[model samples]
Target chain A: MKATNLSTPKFCSALQILGLALMVFWFAAPVLQAAETLKLSARLVWGTNRDKSADDELKAMTPKLKSKFVNIFKWKEYYEISKKTFQFPKHEGKQIRMSKNCEIIMKLLDKDTLQVQVIGEDQLQRTVKHPLKPILTDGDLFVVGGDDKDSYGDAWFLVITHPNLGKEHKKEE
Target chain B: MNEKLVIQIQAYLDGELSAEARLQLLARLEKDSEARELCDSLKAEQSLLKDVGEKDHELPVAHSYFWKAISDEILPHPSPRNQTRHKQTAGAFQRWSAWLVPGGVIACIALVVFQKGLLDDVLDGIKSTGKKAARRAPSFHEIDSQQQNAGFISFRSESEGVSVVWISNY
Candidate 1:
């Protein structure tokens, strides 16, 4: 009786087919996600556009600033720097010192809003509420700035948001 | 032809039997041709093993050439000095390659940061003076309920490339 060799052509072909199927599944899985869901992100940026452009004028309406584009408080950047700088269970008085003797006082107003008070070296204090929108869509920019008029400003709070940008666009509240 | 006699003959050749058992085996060997043949075979095998183990014994072929062919096929031997040099080069390469991981991570971070700076420049350039109405109105539901409760309203305009959010109470 002839013994059968385990490395037969049919067995190898079956293994190759299985391996090919796994590769196909691995590559195709992410593409099969339901295209209906919308993804969004929001950022609260506090910077002086220091530029003389009218848009910077509108965005940076604060008066008496030192340098342009001085990012005093950015929501994402601040929190990241703060969490790393401070210990756990952060308190109200937990402050992050910015450029030109500007100190940022953080307070959680609500689940969706954070109150940041930017006090400049000149003792000019500007308080702005940064709202954390739960749902963000594409191309949505939310800007919250201080009432700065001249090229020099104390601080500006900007929030960029993107909302309900989905393929279906079936209005989701 | 008896199996017991055959065993006894082998035991006698090996000197494992007592004197009385040896004498019995000798008598049986005289009577049994099969027992005698078995004893002769065992003796011949013992002598053959001795001859093979003896240093003066000659092989059918040259031993050095025979073993060298087998060693070449099993393992190709390189010069020890060259092997040491190759290993040192490989080790140096491995040590250098170890730095590549952190280097790659830093490079990726720098690229992202550089790209972000470029994007910020472009966005800043695009943000000029404009107060035109937004091309698309923000969906009412897109407004967060928390912001509404706080008297805050968010208005986004991509054309303006700026989002204007304000508090009504202020």
Candidate 2:
């Protein structure tokens, strides 16, 4: 082999070509790898909802939370612990971390029957006699038909026999 | 015509009568003009009844191709133009928005300037009234609870609640 000197024009061209090749390789490698295997993730706060999608409903959730996390956080994400089952990360408290997701899809189902009633604004009772009484007071929801005053101009509420939703909720207009 | 024959003629037209009644009505139709007219009217009515129940109608097509056809015909022409116009309109709106913040601040400042004199007069009146009240007001100190119970109580002569017990004239 003929030994070429370092100052040769051919040596400079070869070095320039090698540098360009390395630049192109590293630039295109990441793009190709990203297209091949993508790792999708979203950021979530410590204890709140994500976007407006209702797919994230937390129900039967009885996680003992610390005061700093439960009150101050604006969002929360979740991850799967097992197959189709998941829990919030136990980082500082029992709340989820921001690494998994900002939203947790916890679908809730009512096991028992729900009874709804309306409370009348007027003091007098109605003429039509119902067999069962209402469970709630005036302007309250009845799970099994409470003592709701059935008359016009009275606000009504929803009552569920389910333990997850035992409290009275304002009915949407 | 006899009443029994009239009843037979009615029953024959209604298909309730025997062959004798039908034969009798046919013979009467040959002779009686009114009987023939009634048969012609009854046949017309039966034909009309068959047509009454039927309507030349059709069910609505699934998914309503009306909107789809309209979309296919009208959408491509306007969609890109609509997007362009939307962006243009948004640009115009953003340009207008640049003026809005300054305009709102100017309006708020103008409103405050307009109401400033009235608010200042009210505040000035309140201050003068406070000064007048301070000057006209009494400087009496409230006696301690235990001290008041131990001694005879006194009220100013202008007091509304009780008569004065420590008047100099007394």
Candidate 3:
């Protein structure tokens, strides 16, 4: 049998391999970037002048976080009714139930943005999009709150935060 | 020669005319010499083109060289000094073009990474500024409440590092 000229120069073959690798990386860059998920924590807090919560399961708010609310609003005490820690994928929405009557839908709009919809009594109360970068980097908080309809002068707050940053803050505390 | 008769005769030659139209065209072709001549010329031209297409024809030079020669002939010839300058310019252009695709790809990747980093930095700066500002300042980019029974107000206390959206009457 005649010998076939299948041999390619080593340099050319190496360059070809490098090119193939670069092409694969170029195509995969976006997908790899998109794989990153945003971790968040949402808390349903009840604000009242009363010293204690009627539900024993409810926990008092962190002193650092509650002081923030006390400075801004009229509520004397803030109690955490429910808390959820979840991950948000890019452009996808997640519905989180904070209580029987309170629900929140959060969507990761992009790398630096989050869309939040507050649902009270199965009705959409508000929709907000928050710039995520500041919240993620600066440990900023996003809260959706309203007056407690059942109780006069009582209020409810839905607070959102970056879980990692929140944990770091707690560690520092 | 009538243009209509010429078309009919051509269509009959191509076997495209209806049977009744072909018979009428054939009768006219026997009676009209000018129509017959036009039909004969169109057939001759079609046959000549087919023959030229079917015959194998080879270029005297390589395909690239052939095109280059034709382009050289069509484009103006430069002076010796100008030709050297042109070659240098072309060489530089070719070198740049070689790097253009890879450079562009790298630039795009860098831009995406940089923009993401920059966004974090800028937003951090904004938050810092908001923190340094007065109490009850807003931090959210947008807030839209759709419920008629409830109205909402949002603010951020940078000192507390907390943002609040207070919905009233809900």
Top DockQ hit: 3
User: What are the chain B TM-scores of all models?
Assistant: 0.33, 0.27, 0.31
Which portions of model 2 miss their true places by more than 4 Å? A1-173, B1-40, B48-72, B76-111, B114-118, B130-170
lDDT of each: 0.46, 0.34, 0.75
Predicted structure 1, TM vs. truth = 0.26
Which tens-of-lDDT digit does each residue in B1-170 have in candidate 1? 77787777777777899999998888877887877888999999998988787457775888878876776677656689978987787677556556654555565555545533555444534773433332234333222322233465555544444545554432
Docking quality class, candidate 2: incorrect
For A1-173, candidate 3 gives per-residue lDDT tens digits of 23333332234454556567667767876786677677889999999998673656778888878777888888898999998999866656889998998888999776666899888788887888887755766677888788887988888888888787556657868
TM-score result, candidate 2: 0.15
Maximum-TM-score candidate: 3
B79-164 in candidate 2: lDDT tens per residue?
Answer: 78777987787677667656655565565555444433345445545765554332222223122221222342333222111111
Best candidate (score: lDDT): 3
Full ranking by DockQ: 3, 1, 2
Winner by lDDT between candidate 2 and candidate 1: 1
| Pairwise DockQ winner, candidates 1 and 3 | 3
Candidate 2 chain B superposition, TM-score: 0.27
| Interface RMSD for each predicted structure | 12.9, 32.6, 5.4
